[model samples]
Target: MIMVNRFSRLIGTLIDRAAALQHIASQCILCAAPGQKGLDLCLPCQLDLPALTQCCQQCALPLFDHKAYCGQCLLSTPAYQRVEAPWLYQPPIAQLISRFKYSRQYSIGKVLSNIAARRYASAYIDQKLPDLIVPIPLHWSRQTIRGFNQSEHLARYYSHHFNIPMKRFLKRCRPTAAQQMLTADQRRSNMKGAFQMCGDVAGKLVAVVDDVMTTGTTVSEASQCLLKAGATEVHIWCLARTE
Candidate 1:
């Protein structure tokens, strides 16, 4: 018992020292300069990143002028009540996402997710946090091929930051063509019957998490499934949105 306790303490000390060394040695992932505030980014690059300042309250589409909701959202309300994205899909943000999503660089993903969570924490100060965080699911076959789900990682960060439970409430029932290859109308049609609820969400406020939103069709479909399962409300939370 004495030896075991001593070994554990030694391991803990080593881990603490390693973390401190990492902080001191950190460099910006984008510029390879010294990182700031323990982020894998410098202050200048962080400030210069494309921010989603003015956008629709409902869909989060970039707006030319300040507006409560977009024109399309006003005509056809989506299943989700609102969307919140911290960045526009441009520049270093897009490059970071591509690395995280395709290159299997989880360190990059963690950096992006951390920045997004901090921004979201401030944005939701006046609003109530959701009861659950649900990640947009990938089809099993695709997930198997990819070896992981990017949205799930994002959801995990939000879950920890907000102290909300993360649940796999929705699952992709069928595989569909990649949304990136489809037109807006085709994307909408392709997602039909794509998601199915796996657990009861009756009267629960669910925040659906995704890496990015383009046409917003994927999240909309997932939200519809949660609503059909009797969720009281659904909100979309993503890292970035295409302008």
Candidate 2:
């Protein structure tokens, strides 16, 4: 059943891209090599995608083993229940995020979300999929500046693939400092009271989606809000986690 659905999605994507491919048919995204059949990437560039096979089950850090939590996650603990990320924040994927988010190539959001949905389906079949997906919210000011919230786009992709629902469960209370510029302590403090749960997620399984997670502070704060709103658990599904 899952395989059929995935195959259907792949075919649909290919058909959807048929028109767009006319302009860039033989191009590899990462290395600028040639392309294969209909894939946007040549085999080499596609195969070379940086991935994290071994990581902490709870935190998604590139790790020595699943049993070994990263020292940071072990020390203070995080608010999210579990984490899953297919890629490490490196190379082509990292640059892809910049091009997508900072450059207004919103198409990247759909591409990354599709990749994440496929990966998540492959890895987690038996687990109960989340009852609802929540995008890590951006403050209106920042969203105004950026024009749109990338995470919201990514969350919608996952919601479509998983046949689950999506809700803007949390809202950014205000524009906190850009987390990239903050110290770990500062990151935590910056996000404090930055989000509020606006609707019921009580006793329901929730998955929070995002593009990249660095210190996990943003998702942690978001999860804290949902928990306070009575969510049973909050797993994180992100495109990449910085190692």
Candidate 3:
């Protein structure tokens, strides 16, 4: 029985390792070079991706001054207490996001989610993890066309990696115009009252997940909804941010 148990454990380990390798891309998605460290991107390409090293604590806008918060954030803090985005909305990363979002490229989305999971793990090393993960919802009309919400896909990855529960707690109250097409001021107004909280988040620390944050109006509106629903604190997490 002891020998049989040992054999079983060894087989399980081998199977797990094999499954992991199967998921690792054999060629880089961008350069067709060998994939790096199980990612679909080569090391050179990965290093070339825009990283948001310094940014506002509240908004994740790239920072130039040696200050913790940006001038805009200092002037008027956002509703969410914090925001984290690992990459800037630039080439390669931007292209990858476009493919993942519009082209329905699951492989690209997997790579993006993996990158986010790694960064977020280190980011909260000394901070408390949120009590719940919430994905920004798509209105049913739009979701019917897209077939999936990209934010929900990323949120699921975070929940699994961090061993935290994820909930679709917010509902898109109305289908708003595409944010990218609107001016900054128009974008802010477009997201107004766009989200409604559907669950009891009273006193809970909630992390809201999205694909990209441009003017941050969408996330701000979502955060406001959660806060009004009694959430103690709200944090925004996204794959990329536009500086």
List candidate 2 stretches off by more than 4 Å. 1-27, 31-39, 65-67
TM-score computed on alpha carbons, candidate 1: 0.90
Residue range 1-243, candidate 1, lDDT tens digits: 999999999999999998888787777888988887567888888888999999998899999888888998999998899898999999889999999888888878888888898888888889888899999998999999988899999899878877899999898889999988899889989999999888989989999999999988999889888998999999999999997
TM-score-best of 1 and 2: 1
lDDT (C-alpha, whole model) for all candidates: 0.90, 0.84, 0.90
- Encode model 2's per-residue lDDT on 118-210: one tens digit a residue: 888987788888899999988999999999898898888888888899999899888898889889899989998999888899989999988
User: What's the TM-score of each model vs. the native?
Assistant: 0.90, 0.85, 0.90
Deviation from truth (RMSD, Å), model 2: 6.7
Q: Stretches of candidate 1 above 4 Å error?
A: 1-19
List the candidate 3 regions with Cα displacement exceeding 4 Å: 1-25
| Candidate 3 lDDT | 0.90
lDDT for 76 (candidate 1): 94
- lDDT by residue for model 3 (72-137), tens: 888988999988899999897899999998888988988889889899889999999999999999
